[model samples]
Target: MGVTKPFPASVPLSSRAYIDRMDAGLTSVAGAQEIISMISSRRIVTKLILGHNELSDNGCIVLFKFLGSAIGRKYQITEISLNSNSIGNRGLLAISDYLQGNTVLKELFLQDNNFSEDPEVFITFIRALNASHLEVLSLTTNRNLSDPFAETFLPILETPHLRELHLSAIGLTPQSGSPLVAYISSPRCRLQTLKCNGNSLGFRAVKSIIRAIERHNFSLLTVELHANHLVGPVSSDNTSEEDGDEETGGPASPDAWKASETQIRRVLFRNSHLKRETEKEAIRLFRYARPLLLCSSKHANAPAPSTSTRCTDCSCSEIPSPNAPEPEPDTPASNRPPVEGIFPFHALPTELQLYTLSFLAPSLSPAQRSRIYNFASSPSTLPRLGLCLPSFSSNSRNTCVLDPASMPFGLNANTMSPGGGCAGGKCAGSKNSVLCHKEKQRGEWLAVVGCSAYDPYREGEGEGVGEAGILPETGGAV
Candidate 1:
């Protein structure tokens, strides 16, 4: 029995402790207990590396038991490495139990351990990992994990948090390749790096893997398949009709393998480009959609308008100024009706809202844009009309004529202005009518109806038109 050295006091409490292969004697159970006790005492230790120390099942049990204890739970250890430690079924079961409730641990490296001694223990450990917060798991060089590995571990591919997986040098055969192909081809696969080197994968299996990677997977960055049985004659028993040339039952040509590899490289390169583009597009979309999201969130949280107090009048005579103070509601603010047009404005789907905003973004000024956003976000009961265009009839002379009934008030041909500037006669003196600057330059009539309150027949209004009147030449002789 080697004497165990005391853990260095000079090491900071928060720093990772690398005690693997240090000759500090962690091979025996007593040595493992001492080190674990030391680690448990320092609650700040976040990473414990003890690979290649030959910590057999006995020693690992002591370490894992300490990890599962109430006192061990206090340590902020996010990572633990115990590779080549000679750990067996008991130690794995202990680690599996520890992992079930552990949320802080993100990485666990148990490569080259004695997991093959009892395949059931390996399966149990993997199942426990599905519930844990582990992001990176490396279980390489644990031989004889052939078909069972595929059956037990394929479901773990759906785990959202797992990003990198290393299962190289495992005793995986061609039979284990199809399941791997299926899992990697799935949309739920989030693995970024996959290393499966030094396995007994044949040409068909490697080809299938390449095909899946090229066709379905865009997230995998690195796929290592070195030292595998990629070249050589494939057996008909191992092949399916999907191989296209399975009837021939011969080795895949060198050109075919080379072409597959080239396609893989091209596809991976494309994935990289697509990933960058996707990130850029996401950021751009978020920037553009932030206002809409905020508006939606505010609307969602805002009190539902009381139907009893809802204003039936949806028309707004005038656009309210952004700075204008909202009038006090007859009922409480919670019971107050939403502002005019707000219901329809917010009724649009989020995508449509984004589309509308993007379409109007180029034309709207900063102040105007801000006012629009404020109107969407604010719960004010101010009446405001959304932007709309009025329909008008045009003559062969390129003159615009307004419909009499379409006007806010009654109109006759005599009341129509000789100058074809606005649809409802000359709007030069009308406060509610605004002339289109662009149309005015071209000597054409175009009127933007600001409000529906402009009545020509009012008491203080100008002279009324008679019934027996002819439309003006500029008014298109209506």
Candidate 2:
């Protein structure tokens, strides 16, 4: 056996120590132990850099113990850099326990470590994150962050003071979409920079993030999505499908994805103060995804009507008094008779009208749908029609018109109402499968009745309808 040397004397402690790149000389736990002894004596080192030393968990644990001790608690460390040191979970757990009581630490760099060896230990470290004052946490390549670990960690990643989150190349997949989106879209999220480069987050994950950014008004400065599986060269027209080459692992018909991407780009690039490099990266990430095409004069806004006056002869109105005379030739169009067989739906009370329409909606015959479409679409009928239209909810995303003639995605009334049986304007469920039928119809009822003629996507409108009752360019049943 080789002769052992006496322990090295501890150097006088200062506010900072940069012991990086000393792997060739001091390559043992003895170095970490000396540093720990100095710290345990409350030597007042506020910054420590032990990077590139290859000091494995054994050496790191010495530092961890020093960090957790009562004297170590007296010494406030504001920054620590243990990158590329091969520190594993055991050392990380010790560090986590130390962090619980240490309040001054604001930055940590644990890149290229072995934290992924046991995700539970990393989770324990994350749990301690709530107690620490960390502003910058970089875990660039702990490849063990698979679906399970991500799910556990994402809920805890909502630290409001965390300004920059570097999660690039951590083995994230599409399964991380929902939780990630929920966190990014949350109002409490104050993260300004989110780096998610070099992961397998496909179109689904990208699309969800894009939608969340727009729908939830995310304020992130920049989101790095470089070198992932979001296969692009997206199509020109909104209708063209994405190429589904198995080699690239891309799916077909990426219109929705393209739309969402374009919207994200718009939001990110809207601010004029962003740096040129950030704008360039935004462009590069969404090069294939086109910007939103502006509508022409054909989609110009129309002023809504000033007043809504119900027609006397419309079927929705209660029977007129016998003494009421017919309208003179000079009567305004709003007082004229409605189209034949079309109910004066606007004449009824709002709630009663909605209930009546919902009752009639399930089994609308082709002829009835046509008549309803004609009356609702007419500019002359819009003044009165505006009175009864559903006030659209901002939260609803699945708005679709109930017209049988213009149903999208090849849908039709036959498919919508398989076994129609609304004989007396009431959609009473049959006895055999009443529960199942009612459950199925419940979704459709909400979809149809909750839709509004003023929806942003309605064919004739520029964007959204206001209270002015301006008729859209395209009119159809709600």
Candidate 3:
């Protein structure tokens, strides 16, 4: 055996030792122990960077346990980086358990893991993380997941301390969408920032969560739902069976449906991803309806007379102009009507409505939304607009930017106002700040919401909707 070196004469305590910084980059998993020893020795070492190591599940468990138990809680180790590790779901689970009492850990990085492969593990981890004082959690670039994904996250929604949650490139499931939906609808979910990019979440799941937070409530300060299969580039004027969803179901909550649609409207309006097919679908539904819902002082009534082609009768001005001439009249137009019978608002199955809305939403201009009254209200004590629509501030990135047509992505940012910081204080000024400005700070928050949506393929992150919601032309109130 080689001669052992003598123990240090004066080892510094984690909380008392002073150091500018510490770089614990390990060449191998075997070196993580050395890192822990070094951290445990330095009583005041505030930051430790042991990321980019190929640590396995076992390695991660060992490191996190030692760090969280001693240096993490005993000495106030605020910053720790353990990214690029092959640590699977088990490693993450172990880390979560260890981090329960570590409050000084203000910044932690553990991205590019294998949690998505077992979504149930990810869901369980998040649910438990809700109870911890975790400010920021990033799980970007997870590859094992892709589509038909869903897992429980209501615990996170219910978490009182957590402010930001990042799950970009995480293949989403329909079942997972419910918690997100409940959180968006819940007034107590102290959710400030949520980012999910490059996943397989379809319009059905997206519509649910987005609807609950329609009209850009102040509670949801920062949101990033980007680079998914649901919204992608296609040939111009694309109209095929693939353009629609796989299936449709009856309405579960008429109020939730309306609420979700309005939220989608707001998102689409702010950043229109519109195309010819999307616009045509919206018009087709109106064509079949014949007359539109009439605006009333107290109660909603069927249309008494045609105002101006009703909601769909207006001319396709590049910008909404109330003064623009009306169409020849939908009544005289040939009756091709929508494929589904009855008006979408009254007859189409809820799931069908969701699909139709996803296809046609690119056409609903937020500028025109100003003309419609708050007729769709939920029984859940939500505002008349269901989710209160923030007043359109011209300077606000959350304001409407609906085009002459609408969005191809089916989402509208009209409701996502650049409101006060975050959905709640737990989000803003903390991890939420990181999410709100993630697009602008990808190099910084490398483990967050995957890459920025501005250009998923970009080197570093670019601005996201919350930071840079600037859209091409077409204006409307928030």
Best by lDDT: 1
Q: Write the per-residue lDDT of candidate 1 for residues 263-382, one digit (tens) a residue.
A: 778877876766554333333333454455454645344663332222122321343335544334333333445688565544566556655764444322233233334333433322
For residue 466, model 1's alpha carbon misses the true position, in angstroms, by: 72
Q: Give the Cα lDDT of each candidate.
A: 0.59, 0.52, 0.46
lDDT of 3 by residue, 76-193 (tens): 6666666677778778787777666555565566767665556666565666565556667666666564432233445344544455667787665444565566555553454457
Highest TM-score scorer: 1
Better of 2 and 3 by TM-score: 2
List the candidates ranked by lDDT, beginning with the highest. 1, 2, 3
Error of 2 at 395 (Å): 52
Clashing pairs for predicted structure model 1, backbone only: none
Using lDDT as the measure, name the better of candidate 2 and candidate 3.
2
Candidate 1 local distance difference test against the native: 0.59
**Residue 310, candidate 3: C-alpha displacement in angstroms:** 71
471 in model 3: Cα distance from truth in Å?
Answer: 42
TM-score, candidate 2, is 0.46
Worst 10 residues of 2 by lDDT: 289-298
Q: How accurate is candidate 3 locally (lDDT)?
A: 0.46
